[model samples]
Target chain A: MFDFPEFFSFPLGDWINITVDWLTLEWAPFFDVITIAIREPLVSLEHFLWWLPWWAVIVILAAVAWRFAGRRIALFTVCGMLFIGVMGLWDETMTTLAIIVTSVAVSVLVGIPLGILAAKSDRVEAVARPFLDGMQTMPSFVYLIPAVFFFGLGKVPAVVATFIYAVPPCIRLTNLGIRQVSSEVVEAGKAFGSTGLQLLFKIQLPLARPTIMAGVNQTIMMALAMVVIASMIGASGLGLEVLRGIQRLDVGQGFLAGISIVIVAILIDRVSQALGRTRETGLRRGG
Target chain B: MRKVLLALLVGIISISIVLSGCGEAEPEEKPLIKIAELNWGSARFQCEMAKIIIEEGYGYPVELVPGITIPMLQGLRTGDVDVYVEGWLQNQQEAVDTAMEAGDIVMLGFINNDNWQCGFVVPTYVIEGDTERGIEPMVPNLTSVFDLDQPECKELFANPENPSKGLILNGPPGWECEIVTLEQVTTYGLDDHYDVMNTGSSEGLFASLQGAYDKGEPWLGYLWGPTWIAGALDLTLLEEPAYDEEVWNEDHGCAWPSVDLFIAAHKDFPDKAPDVAEMFEKWKLDTPTLNEALAYMLAIEGEPVDVAIWFLKEREEIWTQFVPADVAEKVKAAIAEM
Candidate 1:
């Protein structure tokens, strides 16, 4: 058998620990600001969703579904909402929705810029490719540890964890969408004396709309998937219900919560896909 | 060519059939005892140890299934699992009550009494300054949970998020301690000065403490004994009012009651495997003995199964007393060979 000396140990874990400790100490104020920024909107959104009458929310969602996805999906959306309410998971479902919304919102705000950078620069793309792959491939639960360490426990950390887990798809798709824009169209825009910003907004962005929408759709789904795991770090709602169910072995409660999550996922997915398709057709027709 | 191919195929089938027959000729009734392994160290080690003994000693095949408290209890009910070596009954009163009412599970015996203790704890450095580590005494006058009432003492544990109020780290969501600690905070009127931060898991709680301890920062959190973190860390259990059953139940202001860690089995367990059930009745461990094993696990950073084997090899006198002479010899022989 071969042997290795103790002196060869790199102590990577110690170095990570020291770095985390230093970061936490040095950037406490910045973290606090992030916590408040995320927490306030999440709290307001939860309250707004819960405060509205059930019928009102149902009607609103159905109308949106109808406008985007047409009659069949609209019907499905109404039924799903009713089922969620009947199963007595309405508030929990809303809490989960609020979390997904907040996480996706933050992920988009941060992710889109990175996607643009990666699309424009070969060097940036080279660096970002592996990082995005790591983010996508890493188990969502692993995010919760450092999340708790940095944000403390509760919805803030949960949102942070969910954002990290959900952001990769949006970034990847956005970059891909931008790169996939027809080179001829870009050249034509440049030949017409369009500014760089004008080209990006008027030509490339509109062309990439469908793919970016797909990215948004993917980001939303990933965020929802992460909701349950985020409950481990104190994000309340359907995830907590599921966690409670597992803890007490309450099969009924767990199944109902899980079904509610699926229903919510379907509603969001249909509406977003519909919106994307509608815009895609309009672009084709106009062209 | 066709005739030769048919003959080859027939010969291969015949050989496989003979081999399969030989494989099936072994004992047709070897019972598999399914034991539940919990996430925590103590439960994992205890169940693994039992699994090794039952397999080697009684010649009963065993399977270890990993699960948390609730699902494992459910497994016991539905017969998915045959035994759970460490059942913290008090924390799981509701589920235990329901199962007992249905007559689906039975408490075998206490594994250890006074072995499991849960309460508020502070790093020992808070009280006794560590000169070698260059850590100052942050809460020198802190003697009891009551000392937290003092503004200065409360300030010592102030969290960055809520600097106005000190934070007391509670157990994870859905744990029995979370509810009890929440009640205690309200009852003690400490909620005004202290915010109860419920950690995600025992791992989360321990990490918070470990991070604080490494930085020589003051921390206050709910913790228990016979755990690797407790056994390894230098922490001081804060004093509390003596347990008064009536007051404690209604208000939960007093300290946590000592937990009787025990083994529990499915109702049909005895009928299905009488010998194993009987062996479970005799299985018992003292606090120091269990703590020592947990400490060894911590020191070597060993997995539960490996630690169980190590324990079996080292603690022959303790385990041998539980089983008959022949079975004991068998287990010892198995360990020796390993």
Candidate 2:
């Protein structure tokens, strides 16, 4: 009774491996297609980003920053980009920016639809909640190697790992936002004989926009964190720089790269967070 | 005459635009041949050497794919990586044997079998007491691994998290050295007093040692030479019972066996690039030769390419022997131009 059956064993890992092995065999072509789908845009975007004259990019980013994030943030963005340039990490910074943008974009596209569906249906939320929990809790390292097996170890796996790690907050936050919409307002919409689709598109979505924007911010943060860990699988960027610094025991190099990552993270965070409030503040211009 | 001159100038400018394409020098193919790079310095430096020789002497573009031990070994088996400049034979013996048996990868040549050792090591400052740093020897009487079991020594190096047991920094997880170090501690019956910490990765181990070294702290750990760390820092390798194959196989009670280092290739590599493969077969490096390069890299903080260039520039007699006269001349010409 105390020992609780010494012979009893679970084959959880073995089953997972078997499943992965089967998937690799049966889904090689499918995985390759998905890999290309992720890789093509990422590569082109990276090339385009790096190809732009450095000052041109800095100017564009600063302008965008000014539009939503205010003059202070705009100034900060310029200073950060200049620091990155001065440190001779301009090309690597562009590559990292491309990765982050692509991954966050992917997460948003998939997450919002799922979140809306979950908001409409309690059953879907119940089903997705455990997976979202798992995704958030699962160490990014755990899936990194498997991601390589599926995506063949490069930027594709890095993107896949990053999106998986980052997508959960996007989804859960969206769900919360939609659910938090005032029921009285929803009833008012129903009283006007508005169809369900009309209510969702016009009222519910508009009400949830700020919250969804928060979700996007969270996703970007998570993506940034996972991108650093994804360096182990050959994702070159500031992450690789940091890793090289560690491998060589070069403290200054590691700190420099870590500082660069922090700078990028702060820049992305402040800009996105500010962008979220722009509409509420009546500073949104293009809208 | 003015109209003619203007037309000529315009023609010249148009021709230059057609030729220049904004100075995009027609992309010289970026590394179709993938060479696996593991974490350590000597292996990386050797691969850099091979990459240069292959690119210059053999005219094939090569790239170093950053990978860890097991994954890169797996990559070699699956035909994902084309070459391994320095594959550890002793560390992953079983895995390498299995891969070779399956014909997934083949040993192209020996890389580093120069009777190097890996075991418990301490900074020389720990033993000698660095006068410059105003540090006294923590365990002046301690000399061998056996001395670590003493009460004072154990208390001195006690684990910060669990102070009941002392700490010994082992190699990274999944590393053969980590397993052996763990086993050796148990074999010596020192497990009751000491705990082995497997630093998560090679960088983790290196960083931990660095952190300790910077503070002039006492660190007992597993480390290997022919690395920049070994070259840059003065460390003392603790004594163990001389390596006995029977004892090591039975209980890992003895020191690490100096096994042959090997250069391996994907099974299909010979067919894909036969000349490069032949050149690889001739490519050899000793620990001292690689250590010199690692030291240079440490001093200058140079890239692998820079070190390789240094080697080509300085050690012409060494590399010139590995290739044909024509190939050597070609490489020399390339180096001269570079």
Candidate 3:
């Protein structure tokens, strides 16, 4: 038998434990602030979504679908949402939707600006590229540990984990979108004596609209994907339903909730995609 | 994007096909018994022990399939797994009852009698002042689970997020203990004084306990016996009313019942392989023996399979009691050579 000497052994686990302990003690107030900030909006969104009548929600979704995608998808959205309601999962679906919306909103708010910074500065790009790659490639399950340690347990940790897991694609795409704005267009903006902020808002952003929308689309999908994993840390929704199903070994229940997730994913994916296309078309026609 | 989507779809379909294809017909000469491998140490070790014995002594190929309790029970019902080594009876009573009623599962035998215990626990220091460490007892008079109803006691374990109500750290959501703890809170009329905070997993629950223990903070949570945590930590199991069969079954508050880990098999198992079924029925490990093995694994940080192998080699006398003389000889010889 062979073993590493005491001196040769690294104490990475101990170091992490110490660091986490210290942070929990020293920054308890900061963590409390974060929890309140995230939880208040999340609860309100969940309540609002739950408060709306199922038919009203379906009609609103259908109308939005029709406005962006067309009548066929609108009808599909209505049928799909109605199916979820028929499954007795409408409330859980709404909760999951609220989570996805909040996470994606946060991801976009944080990601787009970081992406813009990365796009502007080569040094920032160099720094952010690997970080984004790491965030994207790291197993989403690994996010739950630090999340639980930091936020105790509940929707806040779930949102934080989802944000970390989902923000990368938004940032990557935003950076790519802005970078892909043609240099000639940028030169034209400069020739017109446009300020940097004016160049971004009036020209670059409009030209990069489709790609940025794609980023939002990816971020939304990624956020939706985190719903089930987040449930493991006490984020309530259809994910918890699925988790309950799995815990009790009820295949019928598990599959029903799982299919509900897929349906929700498809509805959100299609709507976002259609919205992106609608914007692209609007920009193309207006320009 | 179309090409990428098409490629992904094709890859998924082909992989699924290949996976489905891999479950080809077994050779008639040697049958395979699929054993369920659970996440915990004792369960995994017992699974491997069954696997090794069934393979070597009985001349059957054994496959250990890793799974959690619920999915494994489902597998047992669906004939995907032939045997599950340790089934905690009360915790999984609902699932087991439905499966048994449906005639898909059979209880083989008790693996151990009155070996499992679960209840609210707190750091010993909560009750006993640690003079060496210069720490006073947080709740010196706290002994019974009912004592948790006191506002002073609740204040000792006040939840950081919800200071209005003390938090009773329950097991993960969906665990039987989570529901049980919540019911206990309600039944005891402690709902106003305490909130059942469900941790994400056993690990999370223990981490919270350990974190508080490290800081000499008062903490209370649900925990079970024959676990590494209980073995390693100096803690006290809060007392409750003595077990009552009628009261225990019908939503009454009482101490956690002493659980007997049982072996479960597919309903068709005994008819298909009577000898293996007989061996399974006779299989038993007393609490101390099982605890020793679990403690060994925890001490060495050894894998379950390795622990199983060690158990076979070290404790041949105990397992040999379950099998016939010839089979026992064969198993002993196999272990001797290993």
Candidate 4:
């Protein structure tokens, strides 16, 4: 009998690795392009040329909350900002906030319209639902891989990954909100000879405002969760602090950063909830 | 005249704002080289050293990306990461094999070639206890793997993941220990003597090792060298079957030889940022220096940056190897002035 030992004598591992290289050659450039586009801007913002001041941004945030939400939400926002400041993580928190805000803004611009379209057509919703489910359920780490593959790493890839994470909630919420519009309101608009655009602007979206806001709220929270994980791919901010803590086993820094994130999350949620309440009151007055 | 002046001022302000929004000339951009740094003791120190040079020494904004071994390799192959500094070639042969085959990564150079391997180890007390049935004093002709078949050695492996039999502590599943240990046991005909218990985190492995060391209990499992575990505890390796390259390769082989760590970079790094690549190539750390840095991070300072600074300060001579002679003197002068 021939000895089987000879079969395993070769550097099987090295040979196998060479084969994998042959396969990935085709798609590497696309990953490189995406990485370059996303990472460069974020890197500049993080390192050399941060545009916004922490206190100024906080003031603006509080002002927006007061205008849209109410006194309670505005107060909560101030407290949240103060907590992070007191913890000495104000800069880190602001950096994270900038990434989240930019990503959410971009995601909304892309997701809301797709959500509206999906709600309007049965076939579209059918096509979108599974994709949304996969997006939601797929492990967050896996999102980073495809992101890094497509974009590379840095601020842009980080944001793209964050967008992937934050988009699902907004899309689902937008679709849900639009679909939940009262049939009577839609009918009244149609009777008034409202066109599709007018109906969307006047009836469906207006009625869906609370649900859409809820979606936005969820998106914000999801984006916050992705912040630290994104740091694994070079998206710096509060998450980098948390990542450093874990890497160096610094419990104090990790927990403090984590607590700051919790405060920010609560602050955002309450402010959004208050805004939703204001919208509800406005709807009541209009009705 | 007042109204006209006011309108002109408003126009200028609006134009500036639009200009700032529209053509705020994009700041000079550079290709970001993503380097994945593992959380393991040596790996993290290597990362800190590389990051210090890349960020401060070379002034290239490097992102010391965080990840575990398997994912880091995945990142490498997929172009998610440009380089990984502390890839242990022998232990991570499988992952490296996959990555290399894909042509996603290139091996730059070795970082350090220190003595490191994995195998079963038992405390001194265990060897002394009931020498025939227990681990000690070569009782019952316990010279080879066949001696483990004795009934008294039943509790040899008892780790949680595989609690039913003799225990073997598993590090990360992808580690070479998994395959090598399995082969060692099989070749020595000790397959029925012990069971391999898989554990995911280094913390888990250490915690178990510490517990056994403290109690002086007979513990046998996979471990590597130049680590805090070896530094902290004293243990002896169990006998292994003789090494035959052919039989070994077929059987998954013995404890892996120590691998040289590397400081790698993307190809564009040299073209776009030659200075950065020059600094990287010149970067090297001996085993003792890395061990000392790790000890400081884990034992003394307990901060990555503090450890990095300490190493940089303490090893001024080592760093001079990388800098130009004049620049090296300047660096020393700067360090002294600071």
Candidate 5:
């Protein structure tokens, strides 16, 4: 079908598979430790999510949504949570929420610093750009096998899958945010005999906060997207229900799970975006 | 100052990473058979059954490695997984053929017995109206696969998406059944009458069928027996000319031969663990019995271990034959203890 001969094709898939087997052969115990490390946080997060009373969770979410996104979204949150409970998908929804929260938290923790570093150095950005692009674009299926191979098929691999897919935008956006911080502000800080640390914390990061928060929002969305694929492999929750609906041809079931996901996404999105908006307005008033 | 702060943060992150790598003890000294625990009711049930027998009776450890089909098949090929308890012959033929022809994997005993059916299936209500449900028959005269070519068939499934042709869904892409089904569609001269729609996976097919079944709408697509769907739904296999292997190899014009799924393993499995291999060779599950077991599995929220325990407790006559009398006694004792 091609105009050119296919002889020069790179066996990237074969190489990746071979590397996975090789890594497994050499570092099985190391990967096992990592598997446990991943499992511990995931389990704790799930427990914490489950520990909160359903009513308390709803009230807290509504309060947060109202404070940030306004009364309309707050009402939406209450209705959405009620629908999830009514559909008997409370446990599944909570599990999914826990996974998303954990992955998003981890991505931000790792991403922002690397982003700061990339923002500082052109060489680092040059190196990380391709890898970040690859992370974002490379189909999760390509890494899914290795993730399962390393973590042994469950929530751990699911977390790892999300971390890879979702972290890139976090890092990239943080880098962009910091770089876009005005040089005039940096010069003013320096001229005032401010130290590098003080300048970065006081001037750069504050200005970059909105952008970083936007990155966090993107990471959350990506994590939600990746969770569905991960569940198809092993991790369970709303995604598993969706997969069940797909496998069983239960349109009603699929729609139910899908609607639940959309509700969760919208709640998180509106609140987070508003968080950034509020801080920016506050900064303007303070300045 | 910034450099010091960055260095501190880096050090803290590194320490945390190292500290979080906690203890997960490995037991590689006592080598265990790894069973590929595929994510399906019947397959998982079989794996759990085998694990119990191999561990309790044979005194060898066994572990279930959870994964989907393709990776697990690769695991079998590479000996990462030592035992795979279910291999559908036609469905996975395209994937397994290369390894099989090369003798990288070994097929042992028939797991499903010689009892399985597969073809274009439609709900009984699609042909005959459910008077109680107040639904009229949509395609009552549709008996054989070729009857789909009837002009009335298009009127039955007319949708905004496709105005000219009715849709008869096919199997997931890359499945051998999809290939055979498409050939049958062309051969029966129904290609013009119906658009061959590919539902991305088995889930896709089930979803479409389920959506139609719930609404009492017509559906015609490839499906197999001994599944939860087959057990739960009232489906009738559209009539086909009896199976002719010669005709099938040529153009898939005839019916599918009764499928027998075999327990397969890495080629070295037989030589390394002859007893386990032999046990696999003698394994068999009656069709109706397995279907009931599948139903019970779904009833209990799709936990195959619970199904395995129940299967052993109930179907003593079937599993007892898989192992030797002494090993069977051991399994019995373990079961009794549980």
Candidate 6:
């Protein structure tokens, strides 16, 4: 008797019953287990990353780079970070900062170690490669649907969608970084009789830092893109103000909010790019 | 490598076994009933009214979720919303049918009929036929939608914004009016006489109407009742052909029939909250009353919540039957607080 489209007519009367239950019953608990054990502490570090005063953030970023990379790279980092705040987009820039920092933190916690394992074992890399491609290639909106289905709407789903969208780059980079860590370095470590875990920490990862940071810069850009899209699923931020303006035909308000987003994007883009450049220069100086 | 491969295989197998063992158990509490609130003047007010009665009056907490046209229907079919007030029959028939077929929603009775309508509207100037020359004079002979199809009349609306393209400001792109009006324009052969402009937001259309009226310029647009646009503008509906079922098919509901803005509850709603459902059953607001209430909210009070509460208070005698007298007293107290 039911004449509805079969797509909507599943035995689960409530779509959320099947979709949300499937997610919460299976995925949420698993994520909770992993996140509590590893991801939580890493997320806490993101707070420290944002807590630096506006000027100090720039100074500290440049200072760290100067000590590691060189003076030219440090100068670029300082100018980029300062430009973002001076554009009057400081608050929005920080919010975008907090989201990206938190997402990348969780992604790194999940991705880097997986990358290490994938690099070490051909079977692991084979299994991971397809999953990474799916994550990267899937439309960002699809990421939000499952997120809302699983977590309902709000900050949590926003972050979840953002994290899923941001993660692939870090994973791919981590794998490449570890694999590209000079066979000669591995040979040298083995010559010193370095154990597998010790050699990974002291040689492989340390040498791979610059490349991994480049991956992180890409992850931040992806996360920034997701922030605007997440407003559709009820994420509140500058993006919501922009959506609100569009809904009301407040052109001035929408334009201002759009400019705010652009300024934040440019700020983060420059700062992260500078950091990546500096990290490369640091490896050059050390080598 | 072999050992690691074996471990990973074992891990997958173990996870499957564990997952199979851990099947879903229905939650102990009844799910929070989600109510979809569409963004329109009367619909928002009506949803808020229902929320007031359900959550505050009856003491059953309901969550109000905001959604727009297609999304609201999708939400109901998905069971994201257990109740939705103001389901317009003319615009929402296909979605309603689809949801019914899926067993995703149960229809509640019409909240109030004889209120909703849509059509070409024209300023009183057009009806009076006040002509200096180029356009036809007011009051000489215009009475129907067809009369506006005159070339001279079309020339009067010649300005782009004037909708003189025989403009009817349609709802969103995919709305029922968008389809029906397009078909009607073709069927009636007024494509050259008029244009149907799809407004991005209802508010924007109302603002344009208000702007036109203030300037004393002749303005006509597509509109419906129990809407803020109706409350805000003084334009009159241009008469249409009768609502003969044969004339308007599934694809077209001829000339905007007066649809009943309805409140649909979950089938289980009466069982769970009999008192709240009773209030919804009795609650009714017709065109004149809704227009007044909308005017109060958007014009005089400038606060929708305040106007809604005021309406509830003014109509307390009518509502007291569904709610206990003491509870109604509490509702009055709540309104006073607002």
Query: Best candidate, DockQ-wise?
Result: 1
The residue-by-residue lDDT of candidate 6 on A126-161, one tens digit each, is: 998888888888887656655544443334556777
Candidate 6 docking classification: incorrect
Task: In model 4, state the lDDT of residue A61.
Answer: 84
Q: Please give me the DockQ of candidate 4 compared with the native complex.
A: 0.01
Candidate 4 C-alpha lDDT tens digits along B1-338: 99999999999999999988876444555567677887777777667766665654454567878887766667677777777777777766666766666665666667677656346666555655544334344333444445666766655544222344666555533355655676777766667657654433354456546544543355666777656666555566666644456666676445455566665554444566676566667677777777677667766635566676677678878876776666555445545543
TM-scores of the candidates, chain A only: 0.96, 0.96, 0.96, 0.82, 0.95, 0.73
Residue-wise lDDT of candidate 2 within A133-176, one digit each (tens)? 99899887777656665664446778898989899999998999
Candidate 1 per-residue lDDT over residues A16-116, each given as its tens digit: 87888886767767877898899889888998999999999999999999999999989999999999999999998888888999999999999988888
Candidate 1, residue B9: Cα displacement in angstroms equals 7.8
Report how far off residue B223 is in candidate 2 (Å): 1.3
Between candidates 1 and 4, the DockQ winner? 1
Model 2 gets an lDDT of 0.82
lDDT of 5 by residue, A154-219 (tens): 577788889999999899999999999999989999999999899889999999999999999999
lDDT tens per residue, model 3, B78-178:
99999988888888888899999999999999988666567889999989978877779888889888898887898888765457788888887667878
Q: Which ten residues in a row have the lowest lDDT in candidate 1 chain B?
A: B207-216
TM-score: model 4 vs. ground truth: 0.46
Pick by lDDT: which candidate is best?
1
> Per-residue lDDT tens digits of candidate 4, residues A81-136?
88888888887776786687778776788889989988898799899889888877
Determine which window of 10 residues in candidate 6 chain A has minimal summed lDDT. Answer: A34-43
lDDT of 2 by residue, B183-262 (tens): 99999888999977645455545655664575577888888766788888889998899989899899999888887878
* Candidate ordering by lDDT (highest first): 1, 3, 2, 5, 4, 6
Per-chain TM-score (chain B), model 5: 0.85
Score candidate 1 by lDDT. 0.86
lDDT of 3 at B123: 90
Ranking of predictions according to TM-score:
1, 3, 2, 5, 6, 4
